[model samples]
Target chain A: MEFGFSEDQTLLQQTVRDFLEKECTPDAVRSLWERETGRSPELWGKLSEIGLPALMVPEVYGGLGLDERDMVLVLEETGRFALAEPIVTTAVVAAPLLGRLIDTEHSAFAASWLERIASGDALVAVAPEGQPLIADAHVAYLLLLSHGDRLYAAEPDHVQLTAQPANDQSQRLFTVNWDSQKALCLASGNEGRSLQAELLDRGAFGCAAQLLGVTDRLIEMGALYASQRKQFGVAVGSFQAVKHRLANAKVDLEYGRSIIHRSAHSVSTNSPSRSVDVSMAKSFIGEAARFAAGESLQVHGAIGYTYEQDLHIWMKRAWSLDLAFGSGAWHRARIGDALTEGGLSAPHFGFEPRGL
Target chain B: MDLTYTAEQQAFRAEARSWLEASVPKQPLASFDTPEGFEAHREWEKKLHAGGFAMVPWPTEYGGRGADLLEWLIFEEEYYRAGAPGRVNQNGIFLLGPTIMEYGTPEQKARFLPKMASSEEVWAQGWSEPNAGSDMAAIQTTAIRDGDDYVINGQKTWASRGAYAHWLFGLFRTDPESSRHKGLTFVLVPMNTPGITVRPIEKINGKKAFAEVFFDDARVPVANRLGDEGAGWSVAMATAGFERGLMLRSPARFQSTARRLVELYRATLAQGGFVDAGLRNRVTQCWIRAEAYALNTYQTVSRLLAGGKIGAEASLNKIFWSELDIEMHTVALALLESRGELLPSAPAAGDVGDWLEGYIFALAGPIYAGTNEIQRNIIAERILGLPRK
Candidate 1:
């Protein structure tokens, strides 16, 4: 069984990373944080030009019909730069949810939004199920809101938004007040319930991917600082105490990476174990990112504590995303329930033997 | 990114499963630490060899099926799934065998490999001495060269499986004046060689899993050297890589333990025992970590097949699996509660499982294979490019 990414996937991820290195620099992110709306239409346009938003939209809707595996690495790139944009909300969550509605009565409505999203004419924000805060709700052209088993698509005029300040300023969150009667009903009943579950898994999987990116950046920063910072006439990295901390973080990141990538594959293929796989990825990567943040700050000593150093941006993002889709403890309990219910039987341990 | 096994791979798996189902002992074999248990395991290895499943990835001439790494992984999965006996020759097949394949002369390969595969000559490692445990470069064991022979002296402690092994492979300081890592040589010696004495060392559970060997003027042929005269350190490092990496500790072993742990938790729950939420979470975490380890290994095997080299980064696998092993057993014991301390033979210990013994063995995981501390240092210095003072 092959577990490596295709060369095309590698090139796509590298292209996005190179673009971010040039356009969404730490300075650019800091500048966005200072703006009132905390949005960058220019950066979003450039990303859309590179087909980031179009990657998940159906080809029938004037967009690329690539799956989660294609977009997961790009989501990781967005996280690496801590890009102050609605890429995950628009591209990862909304586009896929809308594209899935092509078979429903809301097909025309979903297609219009998907076409706009692919061509850089529209932005979408999705409120996570049961979470009141919707990120980038103000800048989004459409909002995907949920009430029980009903999913609705509403425009800014159909909903009132109250801004909620977040620790990660790059994430502009808002509490949306919307009436389901005024918004267009996309799906309901079993269809809506299943779609909502898929949304949660996709959201959590996307966040897990981003957390991996953030953790990798944090470890890189920590190692760089340790190797450069001097203490007692030697690089601080020479000290086992400092080196081991970063090394442990690296170990956590390395193990969490495969889990995240595998989850992407699971979500893309709609594997029966998708939900548990997403939870496992989210829970493990979230904790790994948090640990990396702490070790990074500890390694940097006093400098990493200051906002001027730019390390705090990633650390704050790590903290915010760890609790976003689901917290580590929440997902752990979900897994615990699944295992206890399923009885830890053979082949349930994952990568089940095919046709055996 | 396909995770599905191929048809051929599945067929191989089916073949392995059927054979193991038919041949595996109905009753569990004893621990290989005892004499009787050691022989029992050796017999099992011979049976496996006869079945062409002893060293799946090795060439056919080496008593294997000449299978790929993926098939080897599948074989390991089925091996553990069938509750097969543990490999008494693990030190040979997993560690020294690969090193020999990499560096052995044709004669050495001919003499050692097939026997190693058949458990005809089990191997023990002699890497650590009293003063050279973590800092192996400080090895004081000397093998002074003579005509076609090396006269060995000094002691090697913590020799795994040495209590019953037929052969021992170790690093010895070859130059009297050379210090640290320099002038060292990797040598293979027969345990029956004159002046070689092995004293069994009891573990915490009073099982003789390892030994301390005192080599006083033990003569070994120079032809028995694995590599160049003064390059033993690097050669042993290669062996250490195998020890700490995927070969020795396959993920199936831990995954099997994790599966059993989940069963234990369920059995405890069915008995009307109060299982705490905290312990349940820990158990779930253990299962997830085991799965993660398995996935990570598959990714690694894929990369290796693509011609990527495994370096100090192998330390990450060592740390992950070792820690996961301990955590899995710890949660099992916690589920067992007061009964966790009871030996398998104790009254009322019925179906308490081998967690207590498993826990004892897991304690050595962090200590052996270069110690987790040394692994961390390797990750930092060699991998992260950290300075060494």
Candidate 2:
């Protein structure tokens, strides 16, 4: 029972980190503010080239078929770099949502879209479960939106889109209004209900994982700033005030990261506690990342609050991600209900067949 | 990372579950701080020892099953799930035991471990002093060597379990002229030694859970020292690492508390009171923190099992769980509102007092085992590589 990621997962993480380090530098993240699309086509193609969008797609559908554990780390790297691409919504969420339909009536359409995603020919932006504003739908080739238990695969041309940029401008949201009668029906009834359930789970959990990564990056940034920034003829980091602030954030991030991994494992393995686990991860990490962002900015003094500073890139993303899928309050409420129903079965010692 | 238990681990869990189910008192044993309660806890430890469940993570040579960290975690989960009594020998089995295993002579192991497991002698920590609570290096308790014996003379305060413990494991100044952390010796001394005096210190809960121990030429044999003279600082830090890491506060303890807290919240909600959204959020956050801590411990345990050692970053674990414990209990107390201050024995207190008791004890968590303030400094300097000014 190993809790450490497998060698393959470790390699995947390293590869993603290295790729983002090269392709999604702070300057690259900064460039998003000026672009109308708020995304890099070249970087997008590169991510698709490395098969970031294909990781969640089934192998039978021309994709990696690797579990969320593998891609969770990738999403984390994207967060670390504050990468402005829609990997989470498009690749991680949409592709997998489609993959689960491989044995359903939408198999052919799902396969075609997945192949396009794998080949960088199309990006499918998903509006999961209840949300009306679909992120990445402004630039997406296909928009997967759900209402009730029915799912539709709509073309960009088939929908009227009004762009609603997030507080973190790296994300561009679109209020999509599509003619459901004209769109391709992916699934409905029980199949669509199941698909929607997993979609929200993966999306919410992915958001938390990404926020934790950003939290880690922010702590690193804050620590570096404190070490170099002088105050009273000493490194700011040496001051107990600055040290404790960052330390608190570091503690939060560490625990948040742990839960995110656990949540991912729960989703991947289909644990009975998966819903509670995801709720716990999202609610906790949303707060942790917010703390990291606030402390990191405070430690950076004036520079962190400025638009020109790269620190805001991750900080704003963390703030925005905290509100994604479902807010921390929403998740917490759900967990409260769950606790009322089934008082925590186990405090998840390890993932079984528990990942030791 | 998979979280499923292996068949063998599951079987061990089943075995432990059944044993604890049968052996755990239906009614809670009296507080271990009380005289009768102390003996009852001692007997409980012996029962656990006879069942080979005293120190699951320790090696067989040290009266343990040689279980790995993962199994230890599982054992802790089952132990807490079965509502087992708190380990009276926690200071021994969790902190000093691991340190001694790393630094003790084979003879020391043979002499100390079996008895510690069987509760023949319960150990208390004697690290903190009047001037050295957080700054442990400032310890002034001297143990000047006199031939094969060391004459201990100084005061150690806040020695947990000292009022009832039969033995003590602590650090002392071995060299008269050396300063700070240098020239100290880690030693184990019998509580009945001549010139030793234990004065109970009442806790916030009005319990003598700890004491102030004074020594005036208390002669202990040199063989009582665990590591070489002046190596006490590192050895004590290693012991501190154990206290901070998986040993002392297993995640299961907090998790169990979280589960109970939620149950309290559920009960509170059922009463049709104004359980505000803010209160609900805090309660959920408490449970989430517990789960995160458990997951983090498993991750750390996995790392340790795969030949990794916990270092100063253990300060992270220390701060996280300690604070989480306080928060969980605080939430539970908040759920009780006006009844929050009641003692469990009070007829009017109802079920509100256990949380109050837990909250009172948890308040001491960040203060003891090295204050969270000290822990943050370790994290800032050791983990973040920040300078100490």
Candidate 3:
């Protein structure tokens, strides 16, 4: 029983990394960050041209029809490059969410949306009920919103977006107010609830992978800077204090890698331990990202704090990702609940301001 | 990646579990440090060997079933799940046996391995000395050659199972002019050899689980050596790799401990109703770390089966597991709060706490098998490509 990715998966990872290295540099991210919408037409077109937006859509519906395992690697590359586009919101999250709605009332609409998404004609965002922070709501052509047991596939015109002051300018968040009845129905009752639950798992699991990438990049940035930064007429990395701190960060990064990979495997395969692993990845890697970002900043001395350094780009990105999909404590509490309660049944994450 | 066992592996697991379920002693065996308990442990090892279960990963001719590494992992998981007693012959079967299979001559294998598998000659490690714990190259133990025999001298400290082991394996200074890792010899010497002495050193737990072995002109044939005299350093490093990587502490051991820890946490919750979220989070954290390590080992074993060799990065694994063990037990103690101090025989004991004894034993984990500090240095220099200090 192997616990690592396959040869094909490794190849996919390398290809995505290569593509991002060419298309989505720090300059690209900085350019997008300065935009009103944080949307890059050229880069977004490149993502769709490569069939990434179709990775989860069904092949019968004119899409790549790949699994969550494939998405995991792509998401990591996105994190590594600090890609500022709505790929996670559209391709990774929405494409799959609609794929699972084939048996629901919006079967025809979901299929059409999947095709549109595959061709880069549509951008999708999610405003999942109880999870108030909606990603890319302004740019999304369709928003997947859940109300009670009903899943609605809505257009932005039917849903009002109130932009928030975002932690990571590369990716913006909005509080969405929607007319549920005006939207096309996707699913309702048990099917809808199950769909939303699975979406939450997938989203959290995807965030874990991205956090791993963020942390890995943070550590690399830290180690490289420490090696060059001089202290006492020698490299800072030569000192035990600097070495040990980076080593501890390395330890966290490595340990978090195994958990993140396991999360991807289990969630993709629908293993019995999927929820368990997702919680582990969310909680473990969330903390790892913070630690890596904090320590890397400490290692860089001062310039790391500035926007000009490019390091803060990833630092802000890691924080934004970690703060989303549940705080570490929030996921840890679910883990604690699984440890003591009904064993991870209906595991939930994030804020709910309701009935106001 | 697939994480399920094959049908054959499942069958093998069933076979091992059924045998263990029936054969494992209902009552625990005595501690190996005591004389009677030592004999009992030896007998237990003999029974395991007779069942072809002593060393599942060893080749068939060497008294194992010729099981692959994954099967060996499954065997260990089941072994611990069945509440099997600790391996009294671990030093021989896990550490030195694999080292021998790799480096021993046919004669050395024929003479030493079978007896080792059968527990007729339990072994102790002679790697550490008073002058050398983390800096193993500082060993001053000398074994000068005289005709066909080597006159052994100097002292070895912290030889686990030395007090009751029938044989001990270690490195010695074979060349007088040489220093550090040079001129050292790795040899297996019988504990019954004249001029050899074993003195059990009381540990913090008041148990003498290991001892100090002094060689005062002890004489042994040169044939006892595993490899060439000065080449011992390289062979010793391979053995250390095995110790820190796979053999000495399999992931199953920690997984089992984690399972028991969950049971403890559950029982604690049942009786008391609640633990703070911090402590509960810690319990989950420990469980996650154990599972992560187990999966990591699976990946490593898969790599090995596919022709990958373990390297100094195993120092990272050592640091990870050792620290996880300490954290798991420490949190358990905190969960116990007051009963944390209760001994195993205490009236309130319910198989839920380390009772400070196991915690005490775990304290030596990072110290032995190379201190965590040394492991970090290895990671920094070898794995991370940092400058050596």
Top lDDT model: 1
Tell me each candidate's TM-score: 0.98, 0.96, 0.94
Question: What lDDT tens digits, residue by residue, belong to model 1 across residues B288-383?
Answer: 999999999899889988988678888999999999999999899889989999998899998887899999999889999888999999999998
DockQ of each: 0.78, 0.61, 0.35
- Evaluate all candidate structures by whole-model CA lDDT and list the values in order: 0.90, 0.85, 0.82
Please give the TM-score for the first chain of candidate 2: 0.94
Number of the candidate with higher TM-score, 1 or 2: 1
- Native contacts retained by candidate 3: 0.48
All-Cα superposition RMSD per candidate: 1.5, 2.3, 4.5
lDDT of 2 by residue, A166-186 (tens): 787888888988899888888
Cα lDDT tens digits, model 2, B195-295, are 99999999976889999999999999999999899899999989989999778999888888887877777788889755877887787777778878888
Candidate 1 per-residue C-alpha lDDT over A70-103 given as tens digits, one digit per residue, 9 for 90 to 100: 7888888888888778777788888889878888
Candidate 2 chain B lowest-lDDT run of ten = B350-359
* Interface RMSD of each candidate, angstroms, one decimal: 1.3, 3.0, 8.1
How would you encode candidate 3's per-residue C-alpha lDDT over B252-370 as one tens digit per residue?
Answer: 78877776677777877888845776777788788778877877788788888888887887887888889998998898788787778888888897664443766887788888989
- Return the candidate ranking by TM-score, descending: 1, 2, 3
